[model samples]
Target: MASSDTYAAHAFHHSFDKERASGAITLTDVHVQFHNDQGQVRFPVSGTQFSLGGASDRLLFIRHPSEPDWNIYTSDLSILKHPALQNDVQIQRRVQQIKNKRRFTWGVFASVVMVLVAIPLLVVLFMDSLTGPLARHVPPEWEQKLGETAFAQYQMGQDFLKQEESDQLLDPLLQPLLQQLQDERYPFQFYISSDDAVNAFALPGGIVVINSGLILKADSADELLGVVAHEISHVTEQHSVRNIMGTAGVYLTINAMLGDMSGLLAMVANAAPYLINQSYSRGFETQADEKGLALLYRAQIEPEGLVTFFEKLREQEQKQLDKVAGEDNRESIESTLQFLSTHPATEDRIDHLQEQINELPHQNTLDLSLPFTTLQERVKRFVAKEDEEPET
Candidate 1:
């Protein structure tokens, strides 16, 4: 047993005013001495008993019950283990209770913090997997509404060719393909854009648009039909709508997790316009290609038309690359082909289409008798007329 006189502790002393006063407390069998700047004051153990109040592992707290403002705190263990205090049951029990409560409180606090951090982390990690199911829950009518809004916004400043003669010539070529792919749920609306780029895109619901450049570039009516068939499949498969929802879902999930409703609302407001210009993922593009080929097979149109069109695009891409190989305008030339940038690699698509065609039973070549040359001439004339129009 260590002597009480040998057990002294450095501590902070507080009086009724709650001001911290540095002091050393020394313990003896009959009294406790507090030595500070003012003087050495003695507290008789018999007259002044101490109670432990919310102590920690590295610290001990003591105060007189009768004099509530008299408090002492120390991080020294030896003072509590002195011969004069070791046998006190009250002090031992109070210290044990404080330690237990401290551990329990820290455990609860740690658990709560972990749960708060983990919930958002888990959401972000699994967000990609959740996109499909969440997208499916969006109503078809909602998709149509989005599509209508996007189509209206997309055509705001674009030149939409509306000549009756051109429509008459183009409608017959598209009617058969539409008849093959149309369903009661989605009534397709087709549009022709006078933009001089080999591009076509589908909006959510059933809005499909084709560029005049693509039509003029086609070698045959079958190639144009194949392009139309591919875009049709995008609508039929709801790829456009699903792709939009997938993008918006990720955006919304992250913003919601961060507790930013303003950002989320802003995203929702711009969603339709953003989706109008967004490109589909490679997987969605592949699905469209496979389904488009199937649609052609079902319509008795040669699948080779799709393959041939892809081959032509690839050849054109190569020619463009060669032309810009050593030129300073290579970047500009590459950026001009927006269709190639958006679609999957042409070479891969061509190979896949050819593979599908090879699996089918051999058949005679399609009769390429459609007035493709006449349509090209008409497209050229319309483009020339548009170019002649003064810029507003």
Candidate 2:
């Protein structure tokens, strides 16, 4: 551990009195040892705090749980180099910043509350919205590291498409999106899962998992990229991280991020499965749709792909619904079957998407012209082969 020489400092003479005392204090990365006429004492640096405008603003004001009345002061700025002090300051600064972002002025709140009262079903969206501010404060590097850890845990015991298989299908389609990339924080990654569902989900940071079934159902690169773009919007907007933070209490999430990383790790470990099963809020889904449409526009691709894709999901969902019940009884049973999917497509959502598409101006979009039929066959063949392999 790093240590410093004994430095001259002063503290309260007695734990009970206001009298001052002289002491020689030594600093270490983990502990601060003070020796005086009163004897020796050690305080763990993890709990030590420093701030300005205490007994002596000119000198560093050190406070410790062990010496509540000590009111220690040191002229030597080297004490600030202590790991505990640095970490405490950093965490406080970050927490304050995140908290500040989450707070709004009364004027703004008053105006927003008016709009919110008109929309009560979306109040749940605002309840979860608190997590977004904190999510943005998590440093990109930390976010990436945490996501990789969670993703590793999630990938275990899951059937994912082979790298080559995924690369052949996705790399070309992702080019336009990649070309329009703006954020430098996350190393955006995409993977193809071998699940038999036409769905995709985003992991915290920039990891997006697309099911092979979605790809198999898509007729062209445009359709697949549309879904991929929506999922990417979830990553870029920090929705995945927000969801994770929301699932874990905000206090726990903030504390875990700024204090004990183990709490954060354990929470994500237990919650990773739920993350996969979790659905975006209607509000969150709408935001993703709009942002994803913007992404498609910026990439110079036809934005209508999203509309078509949503319509496709809606059709398939209807077919599934028809298989279970006749059309006459479908309305009564649709609510019960809502639990069967995390991604719920609706006529309203599709119509809203179409309205959005109508607003866009014409663009000479790139035609990827991917060999969808051949690729679909390849995906089918590989999935079947993998499914037949014996587990060793």
Candidate 3:
């Protein structure tokens, strides 16, 4: 506690040269004199200080009227002895610099830690995006039900094909291939449609539909096998399931990053139709192609057949283009061109298959007992006879 008589004294020095320009000056001791409120005697003040700016030529002094001879504190007098507080200023500056440096270092360290943590988390999210669709979140039965609806479309397609009598002709060629690929754990059903469009598609529940045009256009059994292999890979991998999960995961992650994940479930729900119909991405196609080729190769089927098929399809596309007359027809024809529209264009796919062939060390030729041409003709006659027989 400070006493009532205690007072703080202060002193300051200013350059005399500036004052000399204005008028005459005198050299004198400089100090402040303090007195209590009662204006009585002075008392000891412990923390007295002085400050100065610029050059000082004169000294100033002050003392209380009552204690005219009172001695100044040694510490206080020592502070005013020098021209400036050089060493003390340096120490204060160094302390401030050290504090700023520590703050900067901590800031950088915190940034580094955030980066290290965030990078791996981002990577995990990205990798998880690739696998998210496979979680089987959609009921398996619903997927099967969707597949059944597509089968009804198949029946409509078959009815349209009855006019051509080409529908029955494709089964013999397809049956053997299906048998070759049949896995007891994951049974697949094959449907041949009368559609002249060169397309083959797979639905969620292990159902694959091939257009008669695909059969008619395929140059060899091997080429057809390539198509078969591709579709079968989609089924065996349950890529549909995987795709659903992957897309959903990505959607959720994006929403989360944006800080609005509450609507992700609804977004996914709305996207269901598009997802169900969605084809695989290019990378997914490559994966399925490569894996399917391995399966075919292991089954002692010549993978080169896949490449050969692509060549034939490309030629057929050109022929189709030549026949179409108008721009609209050209556009329509262009759309039907397998390489342009289908998963793995016949040409690009053929090239990839060739690469796979070159890479595989085991190049064994497949000996298919049934020549596709003869079998195709036989199946055609059988379908015709069966069609001519009656409708029950």
Candidate 4:
């Protein structure tokens, strides 16, 4: 214990300035004083700030009265055992208050960490099961609106067949497929993108876009309808909407679980531009493929058409990649033939679809006898018109 009334300490020049000097400190019931070679300073105890970090550090931390920025940190053994500080009522209460505050802060921080960890863990474990059920709860109108927003964003850099022409090209094929769908919820709308990429995708609201390249690649209306059926299954099976749900961040997922549709919309709107390109997980793709074949069977269309189209896509990709086998500009091939039409490059996917088809009893299927040449001609004419310069 410090025997003398004064104990040595270090004091900052001003405002916790690094220019510090040695001093002797004395404590009183109502005041504290400091003496150094240069001068002496004193301040009332009630207004001064004191902190005993813990029993282990055995240090005294103080803030000067009326000069909060001026602080003191001292580990002098005598200071730790001082009678006036160890016994003062106000000083001890303030120290206890600080200790309590630190405990509370630590408790709050640990709670935040636990919540952060628990949410994602729960999502990973249950998200696959949750999305399908949650999708059913999303109102149809909300889905349509989200799909509209996302479809609108997708149109910025793309050109598509005219509505009249798209109807002529797709209506005959799509009407039959739509008629076969039972208990359908979405008001499915179809568009034909004039681009040459062999891709087709569906959006949250029954919005489906088929690239002109896919139509040109198909040998019959069955093949075209097969692809359309698969895309429609994505909507009917709620995979398209589920893909949107999957893109939402953790907080957004919480908002969704809490039934905050508006917040979910905001997340979708922000994520819309790329939503069209978001690939379905293999699980989602398998579900769509299986459901799509069911739709084909109900429509009396050849379920073989879906399998055969998958085969065509495979042949096309292998031929393209083989041509560019040693070339670094393989990106050039991908830019035009992006077979995002199916996931996994439709790679090894053919075997799965073919196996399913093999297990099914063959049905007497309708021959679409669609006008393949006329459809291609119309697409070429429309694309040429779109490329023409306006007359000056």
Per-candidate TM vs. native?
Answer: 0.58, 0.59, 0.53, 0.60
Better of 1 and 2 by TM-score: 2
lDDT of 3 at 21: 16
lDDT for each residue of candidate 4 in 1-392, tens digit (9 for 90 to 100)? 43346666777766333577777787665557776776667776666777755455455677766755445556664554455655667767776675676567678888999989998889866665668876787778767887898888888877777666677877766777899888578898888887788778898779998888887777777788888899999888877667777766667777778887676566555655666667887678888888998889888888877878888777877786877764676666665555554355474567787888888887787767755557766666765775443121
Q: Least accurate stretch of 10 residues (summed lDDT) in model 2?
A: 95-104
Worst 10 residues of 4 by lDDT: 383-392
**lDDT leader:** 4
Better of 2 and 4 by lDDT: 4
The local distance difference test score of model 1 is 0.68
Q: Write the residue-wise lDDT of candidate 3 on 106-223 in tens digits.
A: 6888999998788657745564343444233444555555556655654642533342333354455455555666454355666555556766777656777766567667767777
Which scores higher on lDDT, 2 or 3? Answer: 2
Clashes of each: 0, 0, 15, 0
The lowest-lDDT stretch of 10 consecutive residues in candidate 3 is: 19-28
lDDT of each: 0.68, 0.70, 0.53, 0.73
Best by TM-score: 4
Please list the residue runs of candidate 4 whose C-alpha ends up more than 4 Å from where it truly belongs after superposition.
1-119, 250-266, 323-342, 371-374, 384-392
Ranking by lDDT: 4, 2, 1, 3
Tens digit of per-residue lDDT, candidate 2, span 129-193: 65566566666766666667667877878777666656777777787887797876678787777
Write down the TM-score for model 4.
Answer: 0.60
* Model 1, runs deviating above 4 Å: 1-130, 163-167, 249-270, 323-343, 362-368, 371-374, 386-392
